[model samples]
Target chain A: MKYRNPHIPEGINVTKRHPLKELLILLGGALLLIVALSWVFAEFGGGLARLIPFEYEQALVPDALLSSDADSELDVYLTQLSERLQKHMAIPEEIAIKVHFSGDDVFNAFATLGGNVLLYRGLVEQLPHENALSMLLAHEIAHVVHRDPIVGVGRGVGIQIVLSTMLGNPDLNVLGNAGLYTQLYFNRDMERAADAAALGAVHGLYGHVGGAKALFEVIKAERDRMGDGELPAMFSSHPLDQQRLDAIEEMARDNAWAGSGAITPLPAAFADWLKTAALRTESGRNTGNTH
Target chain B: MIELGIFLALLTLGYGFGQYAERRHYRSIIEREKRLNALPAIAARFPPTEPQHHQALVIGSTVISVDYFKRFLAALRNLFGGRVTAYESLLDRARRESSLRMKQQAETLGAEMVFNVKYETASISKGRGNTIGSIEVLAYGTALIRPQAADTDR
Candidate 1:
């Protein structure tokens, strides 16, 4: 009897291809097209929006429309800080300062469009050293000097609309998708510019730049305390890698500011004041880790 | 008109899915708020003084959902190595809506300052295959009651 293998009777064995791969290929192509179109529209549409002064003016949202006062002491403190910043930065008398305190204990701070500087109370307490405060404030001031907030918001909204049109949607929720935000993350170029500006401000105010590194160390320590997953997205937003930290240190070393001992004391009564004031104005106190 | 209707139908489907994802996201935020609001206040280094004002503070938020179905579909295409086809369209929509939500809320509240803002997100649906995830967003800030006199100072 002819020994014919039953299993070998089939034609050529073809490797099975997963359906998922094909689907991904299709989806990827669609996404690429969407992105390409969005980029094109944003480039042109933004320019058009700029030319349409009436529409731009119409988009000018009033400050009164989006603010509410919380009976918190931090609000008052921000008012004072804003005034101080305005004078220190030579912010013209005409430009209004919008200061607000966040209810986080992350020892963080940021500048937003239209001269909005948000400082977390946690950062204030953690950076008991005046040099750190100066460093932090000066850093945000650098952002303001660059008018990053306005430029950033304008670009963000413009790009968002273009993408929305391609996506068949209306809004771009920066808060939801971390990846999308990452794409818009300030490039290293912007960070470098901000760093240079911040250094200038720090040298002018504190006579040193090592303080900026100290601030980063404080942030790292705070992150350590918070444990993993508890840290806010803000920490990742600006990013603080060793390279960036080293850049600041290098500037300080070059500027002869490395040995500028103790850039002013942390004030005589700050501790006592924080004890009482923190109790009255702490918003996220209950969480134990409110960042 | 028929073409317009067809386009509208597709738009509505996209919106429905989007909203479903968003609702899931919002529910998570509400849960987070409960926890955050429950936490005790911690002291900052230099706390600001409590303001004495009469004003309404408003904070707005937007939620977006990119259901599991799409993600899974993309993942399958990529051989399930977790490298899915990019969803720029979905992501872009989310970013815009969320930002707009925050802006509108701030404007509506007549707030001169909106502080202590936070963002939270969560997956509305669990598992994969036809199942979708929802993302909820919140943009909240304290509105102040600033006097008319404060406006004139500017």
Candidate 2:
């Protein structure tokens, strides 16, 4: 009787060999798909995002930010400012800009979904005059006019879906990092467009461009205090401070507008409120040991 | 630019070390497998009819970790939803190594053959976010110990 080995098959090769050409082809195909998808999203994402209901966009904001006291002084001030600014610009009636004032001390303001704009107390307190504040507000309003926030969100979602579908679902950490990078890249271009439009809007309102330059100077001073390193221009979402000042001056010269004019001071009540707000923030930070 | 440089450096390191480790492991596995071929473990239900010997259980286990290059390849393969060939070699090496160890144990006991061989495999270390880090393979069998002529005469 003869014994046969069941595990070892005759004339069978167990080792697997993947040719280099096949791997190269796979990589090339994946790269092509990524590029094509990115271009498609860049071209059409804003139009699709605009189709989303205004109510839904508003709902995306946190409830805490929306639930402010009905007639707070800050609210009244912001409402009047937005209305005054809207009167000067050819704003579409369908898109009503709503302003929200946050007590937080972060030196930043942002335009968000639903034509909403946030004004941080820290940045508001830093402005030298009402005209400077108007320049900053105009920049944010331009962002809303262009529907940048929703467009950005739309682009982010589109990219995420494409990436996940192509490569399966990646870890949350990777997805988060990728989303941030994409947002920053999109924001760089959007910011520049907003800055140019806001220059025109501010010029229409004040007949001068000094406020824009002054606002950038304030930001530059803040950056200098923080000892911020020189980040590459391409990687930054906002233009470099010097570049923004230069652009404003060049635009003013080309448009034959006076770059300097009489600056209006903040109203007495608004100025008083700003002082109290700063004090409150200072005390809060001290108590929290955040210094 | 600095970040891109760092990422490329890490990839190069992973590729170099992974290839070296894989080649060394395959060499060891093939050499041991060839030496243990004559005493192959089998899944036969019954021992040989001519056998008048002692039988005892023998077991062997081994754990193998994945190299970084294999892990990177597996991650990319995960996107396309297909066979992860990078993991294929890792599992093959673990199974062969465990079986070789089992055969060597049987040889030490002066066993003629092993019967009813069974293999068990399990994932040991799970990598970050759905990747496999290491795997363990265990091989077991009943070794048929043949009686020596001098001992039978006594």
Candidate 3:
């Protein structure tokens, strides 16, 4: 039977399609587009990073983290170390390195947009010697030299645009989180490349690879203390600590450089300062608990 | 494997229930719209003629919720950036169903036609975290009630 009204306008059937068929087609198309865009961005994003101007890159750094001339002793020390390391490396003339220290207890360092390298106090305090610290700094510096930060940010923005266009709403937080997670996973190869470059820089400056392996050994000890299970290589952005140590050992053997070198202890003054800082933090936590 | 099985189960359930609900809603809308065709709701600025009796207000409203399948589809669509056809049909049903109900109310009051009909829609919470639970549509208008014998004068 025809479901029509004589008084109503003709040819106005709104719900005409088979719902299942239309939905299946939409799902297939959406999946195809997502995979294709992800592949295209992954393949070409590195080349796009090179196109960004040095001035634009500098603009990306937040002013809050930008250190003025009146930096703290720790900040000054890190800056001097980074500068000394940069002098030995083949970094671009336009890329000026800036190191910032966060007083947080998190034992991690990361390179971000505009050649900014962030080091946590927790990581710095754990270093047994300056060379080990240099190894960590050199790794981050390598990332900045290679413009990895800009490439990461570009991939993130690209994924956000694609997702928002597909979903019909600009729910950036959800897509941004996904983009960051994917970027971290994809950076595994970059991490290895950075480690190699950092090893070279350390070798050039100190004439040995002892400090490179020593840093990973320190990290491995810390991981064991915390009882954090090892993350699978497929999921982790950095190579496993054992793998890194082994790679450094192989590189040292190939060059015939003795892996053992004079290990300079952290300066007494810095050690004293760290102890005082830790005591103050502990007291502050106790006071907070009392309140 | 277990997670994938659960996901497939949810998808199947959403597809089956969502389709059934949509088809049923469309059938109701069509039947009601046909019955109310004589009232002739139009978007014109002015009514065709003045009412013999006093004009009274009439309103109809509905809140429609989407099944889980549509929400999943919408979330996927969000990743790629495109039109959310799932929501398009939802709004269409809400608007049409509300309008038909408004006409039904007008008919009960011996009204000849509805004039200056306006629709308003708002998204309401459906107890789901962050996702839209349901959409409410309100259709309101002035009903032109005519005297018993004056209905034929048109």
Alpha-carbon error at A81 in model 1, in Å? 7.0
* CAPRI-style quality class for the chain A–B interface of candidate 1: incorrect
Q: Candidate 2, residue A208: CA error in Å?
A: 2.6
What are the Cα lDDT values of the candidates? 0.51, 0.71, 0.73
Per lDDT, what order, best first?
Answer: 3, 2, 1
Chain A only: TM-score of every candidate?
0.64, 0.76, 0.74
TM-scores for every candidate against the unseen true structure: 0.48, 0.74, 0.57
**CAPRI grade, predicted model 2:** acceptable
Better of 1 and 2 by TM-score: 2
Give the distance in Å from residue A212's predicted Cα in candidate 1 to where it truly belongs. Answer: 2.2
Over the true interface, candidate 2 deviates by an RMSD, in Å, of 4.1
- lDDT by residue (tens digit), candidate 3, A82-171: 888888789988998888765557788888888888777688788888889889999999999988888776766666565555545322
Q: Can you write out model 2's per-residue Cα lDDT over A37-66, one digit (the tens) per residue?
A: 754665467569978876687678765554
Worst 10 residues of 2 chain B by lDDT: B145-154
Scored by TM-score, the top model is 2
Evaluate candidate 2 by giving its C-alpha RMSD to the native, one decimal.
5.5
Most lDDT-accurate candidate: 3
